[model samples]
Target: MNAQIAPPPAAAGWQAVIGLEIHAQLSTASKLFSGAPTAYGAEPNTQASLVDIALPGTLPVPNRAAIRKAIQFGLAIGAPIAPHSVFARKNYFYPDLPKGYQISQYELPVVGPGKLKVRVDDGRTIEVEIQRAHLEEDAGKSVHDAFHAETGIDLNRAGTPLLEIVSAPVMHSAAEAVAYMRTVHTLVRWLGICDGNMQEGSFRCDCNVSVRRSGTEQLGTRTEIKNVNSFRFVEKAIEYEIERQIRALENGEAIVQETRLYDPTRHQTRSMRSKESADDYRYFPDPDLPPLAIGAAEIERERSALPELPQARRERYIAVLGLPEADADQLCSDRATADYFEAVLAGVPGQAKLCANWVLGEVAAALNENAVEIAAAPVDAAALAQLLSRLREGVISGKIAKDVFAAMWAGEGSADVIIEARGLKQISDTGALATAIDAVLAEYAGQVADYRKGNDKLLQFFVGQVMKRTRGQANPQQLNELLKQKLAG
Candidate 1:
């Protein structure tokens, strides 16, 4: 189901203010500040390095690849890339954080203010403001159920590089928040900076939600829903949080400013801990790592290397390709799908609409049924293009093409081979169509007589008979014309 926001029943006189803190793990070979490998599903602490574990006499050095990725993201969003940014130690204590303080950007972020345009489920576009995006190292996992009454710590992710994207509290509904998140998800993947895999913990969201009386300038006390991974869960968590805050205010109870976790099984947000202010974290510049610096040339280099972004591709698909808005949107949702679409178009030029129909219709259904991505589809784009070319040139009817496509997906030979082997070519020959039409008219003589006597509806029956006799391989336009001429006499 598509993620959508439905207003709560008690939300008549109240409004929701939502902002999201998205953590996207950077795609790199090693950790942010050490030489430790950052691969997932390793044997726990085997991947943790001495620097990641905060061993004595160890110092941290920032990964250049991670920094470049952060800059690439900044440029992609049209944000100002800070020439100089400082890393501060965020003082916090957790079981997964081996270091007492997490090294992160506080006052000076790598990326400044930006905005992203999001399309909601209702087809309306809304622009969400980005406050800042800073670089940070991820903490490890605290496994609770791995043991009977004890916990296990996995340090494989402790030092994984992360880009924490913070957005302004400009969203008013769960739907908008989700739309904004999905847009970022697509952008990061398109930029080749982040994998955007939510299940693997490469991408996650912390939703800051609050409710206030409508038409008020003052914002309400907000609670943070931390680390909701999936889009549907994000929407559900925000909806529940919004309704919870509104009910509390209506009942004369003040909403608490705290951090909460979404329990998917229960569909509720429960308090985890009291939210800490910046003062509580005691942010200060790290002494070990010097202030990072970026040059203008580096930013421009990243900018020039970026592929066409999703929004631009979507617009081009609509304006240049003449595709419908919805079709273009779906096509550009993923870079792979969009690339495949263009490949098909390259094979069969001037047939953008037809190419889109086959890709979005037959190709999509085949991928879904076989549980594979477009990259791993049984039928390649060139093969599908070949099939479409045959259909375009009247070698086969649309229905017959579907049959050939199914056969191709099942490891059958090329479309030409299948069509030839099965005698599936459309009967567009004037001689053959006329002979078939005469046979149908002779067999249904009463209907043909009634049709000439002004019962025009019988023409369809005659056409159906001709199609049935031809095994649905008749060219529709040719059959209609020849059948009409035969009935006239």
Candidate 2:
């Protein structure tokens, strides 16, 4: 019980206080402040509404679907749904914002205070506290042509609803931040509130990276890494930022407060601009829209329908299914794969462990290498369950089961149909097995003599001969037992 865990990276004589601001675009049919379509990759400005394009007389309205989604996320994370949250004007003149200032939640957010349990690189769990998750409308894009002169503005993504999830400075290493991001990504996607596609710009992260001493409590100056497009890059960016900061501090140089970009090929973070403080935004209340006021009853309703989260489900799988902790954790890593695992294992008699093996070993491996989900897998759940039942019943050898699995993946028929069509039934009949063994013994009289002379290795030879004689149809246990009895006699 007193096992030593791997300690966090070198103390640097300074403490790193890490925090995260995650922007997850809510899944909805229309834009957040307009009736225009929120679809991606439209003809430039084609989906723009009067409000999105910010016509002189256009009035902004909140999207009801996006509001409900924000509530669902807060409830899922056990965060507070603020009864009173305001819309603020964050003033920054950029071409993407048709409105002079973008409307966002600043003074009071829709949700506040949640926590994420991240698995560190050393297999230890660290709780990354979340300060708040707020709702805000996204701005449009400014497209700069590499070869052309004019800077074009696309209002297609304008007024899109984005849930800004902010984390506290609790993460100590790049690995922990990456794990926390994955947990957040899965939670939003599983709840059907966000698409969680970083490449599609639906879910993105800005990590506040800093470094500190191993035992000190005081904080070090942190730099914010911006627009990390993928999970691998997130970790990479944090690592580079950490080393850069530590080097900067050690070399007697001031760590400038700044925003930075991660170069994927170069694997380093470059300074984007000198960081701007909150005061620099010139924050003011948005006069266009009123505050968000969702009641406790509405929050309670969303919480009631919230499905069991990933961590809770993982614990349940171990306790209910009698699986080892590692196996259960692996099985429940994703909601889709976990659901498929349950479908095949539930109600199957005396097969929980075996079913897990097939799932983790075969199904999961296939999915990972091919980069597909169980839902979209060529093999269906029922078909896989039936195949497992066949395996349990001794209708085919496990080797033959592999063949059956491959056949199904290649668009063959169901388990029974495949077995029948391919003549893959297991030979468990005692009489037929005995006949096959007798033939192997007679043909292999020399090997039989060796096995009888206490050359136990020859028994494997006899089993091989029996299988060859039966064309690999013998049930292994029955074959071994029958072979042993006749050989001993």
Which candidate leads in lDDT? 1
Clashing pairs in 1: none
* Residues 1-489 of candidate 2: C-alpha lDDT, one tens digit per residue: 112455566655555566889999999889888899988877888998999988998898999888888888887777888998888888888899988788888879888887766665477877778888887878888878743888888889989899999999887777778888988888898788998878889999998987766687767777888888798998888888888888887888878878889999999999888866633877777888787789888888888888788878877877777888777777767688778888887636557788889889888878778898788988877889999888888999999998899888878989889999989999999999999999889988988888788899988888988898888889999999999999999
Tens digits of lDDT, candidate 1, 1-489: 132444423368888999999999999999999999988888889999999989999999999999999998888788999999999999988889999889999999999999888888776777789989999999988999879888898888998999999999988899889999999999998888899999998999999999888879899999999999999999999999999998889899999899999999989999998765523998999999889999999888988998999999999988898999889988998998999999998989989999899989999999998899998888888998999999999999998999999999999899999999999999999999888888888888888788989998887898899999999989988999888887886
lDDT of every model, 2 decimals: 0.91, 0.84
TM-score for each of the candidates = 0.94, 0.95
Deviation (Å) of 454 in candidate 1: 3.3
TM-score of decoy 1 = 0.94
* RMSD, every candidate, angstroms: 2.9, 2.1
Cα deviation of 211 in candidate 1 (Å)? 1.7
Clashing pairs in 2: 11-213, 14-212, 14-213, 15-212, 15-213, 16-211, 16-212, 18-169
